[model samples]
Target: MAAIDHFWAVIPAGGAGTRLWPLSRSSVPKFLHDLTGGGRTLLQDTRDRLAPLAEDRFVVVTGRPHREAVLGQLPEVAPDLVLAEPAPRDSMAAIGLAAALLERRDPDDAVMGSFPADHVIPDPHGFGEAVRTAVEVARDDWLVTIGIEPTFPSSAFGYVHLGEPVDGHPAARHVQEFVEKPSVAVATDYVATGRYRWNAGMFVVRPTVLLDLLARWHPAFAADLRAIAAAPERLDELWAGLPKIALDHAIAEPAAAAGRVASVPSAFHWEDVGDFDALATLLTGAGSVTVLGDDDLVRPVDASGLVVPAAGRVIAVVGLDDVVVVDTPDALLVTTRARAQDVKQVVEGLKQSGRADLT
Candidate 1:
């Protein structure tokens, strides 16, 4: 497949990644760490995965504090294209701002694809093909999302309700609605229906169409984004006034309700690596303890879990299964896979105790 002309890859790289504490911090979020021990950070890997489809057409929207770090990770993306938000707004503002800027630069027929910087896709070829189909569908003015074919009934991610077959695109379908994360039992039922897909938050659309859809639900928000795009100098003054809302609630869901959304069912294996459990699943080998860093520094006896020896200290796990141990210079996290989500509570405790530096 060839590069889609005027297609800009917009990356939203702002997240606390609290559950992945010690290794992932607000100062240097998960996207900046090589959680897979794959040499490149998640942000850099995202750039690599998107490079073929987006070539040099890229825009990264991140928080002001992480702007320089995002540049350090992605030297290929032009500095001018890295937009920094003065404050932390949700996905709607981060992605919508990029769309608005592209809407101004390319104006008439430019397409922008928004992907989160922290997610991992092991199958780039399949991902590119899915993106290509999505871009083609987006060219017809439909807000297209790359919906991953469900490998299992996962309660971690939202589901895309697949409707009728789209007229022109081969694998595309009209998206009936976007379902929130369901209970495991409900998710099991959703997977039983072949029409459901994991909503990967991968969207491809013409910038104008995106902003216009946003304008319908949030007129002032859309206007503010456009105004900031028109006068980049005004972002500081105007950004504070914009409502902090997610793009899903503000546009995608409503668009689906209006019969304006389409989905491309994708086979590419994707993972958000939301917590230690996800990271363990991605890196762990069958019947073995997975060490993300310096395997020699880790010693396990009848243990099957994830161990990160980031502190360069020897870590010994004895008779443990499904455990998570992450050691950094300043902090260490010890927990079980069943309670991985509780790590965020540790972060909150640190913040309240005025030890936020350890968080």
Candidate 2:
């Protein structure tokens, strides 16, 4: 298939995946790991999913520590396109930098679709269709996002409220608003209306338009990004002073309220793989216990949930349900699926105890 005209895929791969500790670390994040047992890493899978639509027009923004690793995983992407930030400035600075650079490089009406590097979309075709629609909608000066149909009333994800449809774009709808991660009771009500989608953070818009929108809200921040792009030497000097905030808070939410945002409600199965429980659901079918690593190394007796035997040792579990055991060479994590999100507490404890090496 031919590449989408003026469509550029911007991948922001910077999260440490602290929730998935032992397996995903700051040195090597979850995006760099092969969590799905799919042979390729999550970062690789992200590139593969976008290659059909973007072709060679891809740019990945990551932290300096993982710059080489991002390039190593995505060797097909040109080295120049893999931008490395000197520090962690949250999602806005990371993605905004890509937009700024693309605005200067393309200097044309090219749409940039920002997809986090760690997400999992099983149906690439569905994702592509949504992206295509989003891109077309974006060309009309609307900031578009691919919103995932909620598989369940999930309190862990934010919701995108779908509103009236656009005049010409049947596949798109005006975004009523972007809601915070609601309580399960609130989420259930949202799902009942069939007008809410999980905000997957997939944005499609012209780089200039994105920057222009940023300029409206944060004039100085937008100017700094473009100035760095123009000079290419002031990144280290200017990036530190830029506000560290998520893109959603910086622009998406405000834009939605202003009717500048559109939603392409997608049916594709999307997984953020935020923790072991999520990983367990993604890697295996309906089974009592799901082992992501070597099955022979994991000996489960009357156990339920996930076990990852990555350290090349036998992990035996007995008389447990909804348990998660992740065995690494240096660190071993044992927790229940219900408490998987609390693994970051372990990492925090390690830091406090001066056991940063383990973290």
Candidate 3:
């Protein structure tokens, strides 16, 4: 695919990823690790996937602590292109800062696509096709989001209710509203209707359009972001006051209600790699032991699970099914696949116990 003209890829690389503990720590988050065993970190994979479309046009918004790591992983991006947040303010502020900067950087015809740094899309071609269509739709001043076709009723992801077909773009649909994550039963009904897609938080919009939409509901917030963009030194002063809210609640949901949002439905395989269960599913099939690191280090007799021998020590699993074992030099996580979501509690406990270094 050829590069999209005036399209800049904005990557937001900030998350604790507590569900993937030991291997994924605050100092080295999930995006920084090779979760897929593909050698490239999730952040690198994200950039590589978008490179064909955005080329050298890239902007990475990350926390101050991980800025150097992001730079190290993606040296193709200039140092100035990586915007570091002084403190964690959530998705809206991080992405809005990119929008505010791009709004001024390219005032006329710049369209920006915001993609999370941690998502794993196996088929880059399919993703590229969807993004191209989204960029085309965004040119008409619509807040376009590339929605994933749900493979199952997933309560973990938000849903985009598909409305009427877009007038000009046949591949695009008018988004009725953005629904928050629902129960499995609710998500089942949504999937059965065939009118909903998982909201992957992948947005393609003109920089000014995004900022202007944000301005409608959050005038001061928008103003502050633009002010920081205008005077870069004021970011520290203005950032603390910015509302700590997600872009969905801050803009996307409201825009959908106002009938200004569009969605490009895609069937590409997308994985957020939220936890060990997800990572295991992505790496291998069920009923088999999958080692993310060196296979020689793992010795499983009757185990069907995932193991990461990061500490380079021999890990032996005996008569266990659907178990998760992640060993690092300082900490080890042993749990069942069924309880992978609860791993975050361990991180919380460690933090409370003054063992922040382990997390």
Index of the highest-TM-score prediction? 3
Tens digit of per-residue lDDT, candidate 2, span 215-309 = 99999999999999998899999998999999999999999888899999989889999999899878766768898878899887899989999
The 10-residue segment with the lowest total lDDT in model 1: 284-293
Per-prediction RMSD in angstroms?
1.1, 1.1, 1.0
Model 1 steric clash pairs: none
lDDT of 3 by residue, 113-193 (tens): 999999999999999999999999999999999999999999999999999999999999999999999999999999999
Q: Is 1 or 3 the stronger prediction by lDDT? A: 3
lDDT of 1 at 356: 93
Q: How does each model score on lDDT?
A: 0.92, 0.93, 0.95
Which runs in model 1 stand beyond 4 Å of their true positions? Answer: none
lDDT of 3: 0.95
lDDT of 1 by residue, 1-359 (tens): 57888888999998989999989999999999887788999999999989998999999999999999999999999999999999998999999999999998999878999999999899889999988889899999999999988888888889999999899887899999999999999999999989899998889999999999999989999999999999999999999988888888899999999999999998889988999999999997754799999889999999988998999999999999999999999899999888888899999999999999886
TM-score of 2: 0.98
| Candidate 3 stretches greater than 4 Å from native | 285-287
What's the count of clashing pairs in each model shown? 0, 0, 0
Q: Candidates' TM-scores? A: 0.98, 0.98, 0.98
